[model samples]
Target: MTRRVYFDHSATTPVHPEVVEEMCRFLKDNFGNPTSLHYFGQKARKAVEEAREKVAAAIGANPAEIVFTSGGTEADNMAIHGVAYTNRNRGNHIITSAVEHHAVLNTVKALGKQGFTVTILPVDQYGMVSVEDVAAAITDKTILITIMHANNEVGTIMPIAEIGRLARERGILFHTDAVQSFGKIPVNVDELNVDLLTISGHKIYGPKGIGALYIRKGTRWRQTLFHGGAQERLRRAGTENTPGIIGLGKAAELAMANMEQEAAYLTRLRDRLIREVTEKISHVRLTGHPTKRLPNHASFCFEFIEGESMLLSLDLQGIAASSGSACTSGSLEPSHVLLAMGIPHEVAHGSIRITLGRDNTEEDIDYFLEVMPPIVERLRAMSPLDQETEFALSDRCNGCRVSHTCRV
Candidate 1:
């Protein structure tokens, strides 16, 4: 029997049992509409407010500054659209990087079509967005600078603090999507120097339907997504998702309690996987910044195979992983993050993102290392490039300067 291992934590995680219990209580015994004004309603409302405080405290934010939304997508939409709409008269330009998740990339692109000019800045080979480029791109018309806290695909932690400081000096608003970094790393809004931030619950072992957008006190932002009830301080309007909120609150508390030890454990496992894989596999490029990346993230691009093929093979072996961002799965195009990092199209297609979690173990790393080489060799053997470079498949090297010398 193949041992099942999940290495796609960047996509989502299994809900924590403690979070489930807290949510179940809200779902079964304490069920009520937060706005009903009855005892039941008050009970539900109290839970929601407590969740707001937990989420806010997890990131060193004020409880009043947190507004719950459906998920990161909605939070990102709120942050970008809200700021852009409120400040449209102030400026009509936005700045972002090429490597942001589609939720952000597409959001900014949508704004670009609505008469708001946008500057999509380039990134370095490590997928790090240059702060100097951000400074250079700024103009009087730039209203919002939205960059992610980390690259979801490559795991490259951006210099968000520097960029945030620059935005502050220019008196422009800055927002960072902290969906990936919220629970995995230490995320303090003041330390990052951002006016707004976004986080999702599911990414932190909580329920899926809940997320939050942090609007720093006195940030020139306005509600632009919905119009209805007075929920969420008139920032978002709807019947509160009471159970999901409670689950997220519990998850946040647990994360705050155990973050340091878990981060250190995953870092060791991640380093071992990274070092051994590169040592064993030839014709591979380690994606992302080597030193300053996410502790549990290890991404790579093999020379002569499609990432989807590797994924299928791994799945059959009861190992789960991702070709790139799970949101972009099944797309034939290469990862935008890898391409932005100056990796060739062919190389980018071979991208694989392995994000570890608390559930993973050192034994999981051992099994992965034991199996990965033969898997790569098999895929490479089947690739035409491995036989000889002539008529190589899309996974073939497209003038990549490497040691793949065999030619038919």
Candidate 2:
């Protein structure tokens, strides 16, 4: 049987063995609710708190500042909506980027319908948001600025620290959806100067149902999504997910211990894949900032074919990749992030994201390099746009007077 290769870490990752062990222990032996106040409950409570501390340490925040949620989407929604509603008296305006995740986009749109004006700052060709544009968007009515730290589709690392500084100077709250960047790169709340940050455990090799939000100390925000419990400092109300939280804690700890080493390794593998792919494949272009992007993310768009077809082909070859976010996969719409980066709709439809992870190796990259080009060639051959490309190349060669004269 042929071994399968996974290159879609940006979408999700397999749970680490250590994390699974910890989670299983909790699930099998310690099944007490954290809210019960008994011995078993105390055990569960302690595990949850310790997990909180681990997650906080990963992002350079205090344990108390961390609020565990369902996942990154919920965390982003909580951060954006919480700040918006709590500070409604202060302002009715919010600022975000044109390339935000749909989680943020839909929430912002909902707020827009409720009369809150949202200013979406456009990115340059590299999918980077400008600090100057963000500064300009701020007004007396500006309540919050929510921008993703690293774009999920294109992997562009925004200038979040600069934006945070500007937001601080204007007394506006700033939040970053660090779901893609959190485990892959280092994030410090104070250094970034952000009031709120969102993270997901599944992106870090933990359980999928658990995530956390970082609310800076003294940051004022009201809970937008409320349930019945005293959990998460009353900010997020739900019974604690002990097994998931334990797994998340172990994942965070492992990430902190190995981030630098893993980053360097993944960088090498990702760059090798990119170089080989771009060199061997024609009619393909890289997306996102060349240097200032995630170490593990390599995104590109091959002209003509739909991303779905490319993804299906890759899967048939036992290579797992993604067109865009898992949430928007079924939609026919082009990725907003690629579109925001000025990539044409036709090219955007052919976009593919290949994200490396700690478990991947040079052997895996070699297998992908061996298999990917032919697959792409086959897809391109089936594309109607290939005929147009051939025509254009022929026309260019025919129009070259120097070539014609030399031939004569």
Candidate 3:
């Protein structure tokens, strides 16, 4: 029998059955537009509001602050563009990290075309953004500081709390894309002190095409995206995605309930996998901050073999994994996150990310461990690249803008 395992929760999770059950009421006989004034509409509206409350509770936020959107991408755009356009008079400068999701990086780039000065902060070798660096980047024209709570590719948790504190002190709006970290770890709006944050449903075993953006009260933000019927309290303008909202709410509730236990379980499995893989495979190094990364994430760079080859080989063995962020997996270019972490072009191409989830277990890890060694061995044996080419780091990183020191 072929062993099957899934280790790509960071990309997305199977929609939890409970979430589907919660969404059923909105989809069937009781279906009604939440915007209508009729009884059916009121009922749908009530359920949507209830879902809003649950999502807010999960993140220690007020329900009024949560604005539903199509997913993390839309939420991210709403938060970043909203702040940039509304606060443009305050400052035309925006600050972000190099390892941010393209949703953020590209949004700021668009803002730059509109004459807003943009700063892309570089990361350390571990893919962690620096607090002092953020402080230094702030000038009189710096209005918004957006960084992700955790990286999608390497899973390194950023110092969002510290950065948020600094942003608050500087009177700059701080936003974080928590799409990959919301359910997998703690995400309190107050604890992180972020003025805005983004969360997605599918990442947490909920329906796709639904997400929320947290906008702190009193933040200078306006509708930057659409012009339609007043929905999401005039923050986002569209008919509400009632089913996805309800599913996401249920998923949030369930994740909060099971977080502590699940985190511990995944941590143990992650540590074991990290330990065994490095011990078994020669010339491999773990990516991301070893201690500051997500509890369920274990990424590695295997010398002399490209990540696409390893992914194909693993898929043949009935294991699902990824080279990096599922969003940019199709890009042949090395991960910007890995390159930002100072990984050379050659080694970054060989990176693989394995993120465990609530459904994963010891048996799955065992099966993966059983197959991974031989697969990596086979891939390396077939490779024409040698250690000297694979191991050389300085040549590629020199004069590259991805790393902080290298850019300097």
Clashes of each: 0, 0, 0
Model 1, 1-408: lDDT tens per residue? 889999999899999999999999998999999988999999999999999999999999999999999999999999999999999999999999999999999999999999999999998878888999999999999999999998889888999999999999999999999999989899999999999999999988998989999999998888887899998888899989999889889999999999999999999999999888877887776888888888889999887889999999888888899988989897999998888887778868888999999999999999888888889999988886444344332323332224544132
Report each candidate's C-alpha RMSD, comma-separated, in the order given: 3.2, 4.6, 4.0
Clash pairs for candidate 1:
none
lDDT of 3 by residue, 1-408 (tens): 877899999989999998888788789966999999999999999999998999999999999999999999999999989999998888899999999999999899998999999999999878899999999999999999999999998889999999999999989999999999999899999999999999999999999999999999999999888998778888888788899999999999999999999999999999999988877777677888889989999988876789999999899999999999888988999999988887878878888999999889999989888998999888877988764432223533422222222210
Poorest 10 consecutive residues by lDDT, candidate 3? 399-408
lDDT to native, each model: 0.89, 0.86, 0.89
Q: What is the lDDT of residue 134 in candidate 3?
A: 98
How do the predictions measure up, each by TM-score?
0.95, 0.94, 0.95
Error of 3 at 314 (Å): 0.4
Can you write out model 2's per-residue Cα lDDT over 127-201, one digit (the tens) per residue? Answer: 899999998878889999999999998888999999999899889999999999988889999999999999999
Supply the global lDDT for candidate 3.
0.89
Q: Would you give me the overall lDDT of model 1?
A: 0.89
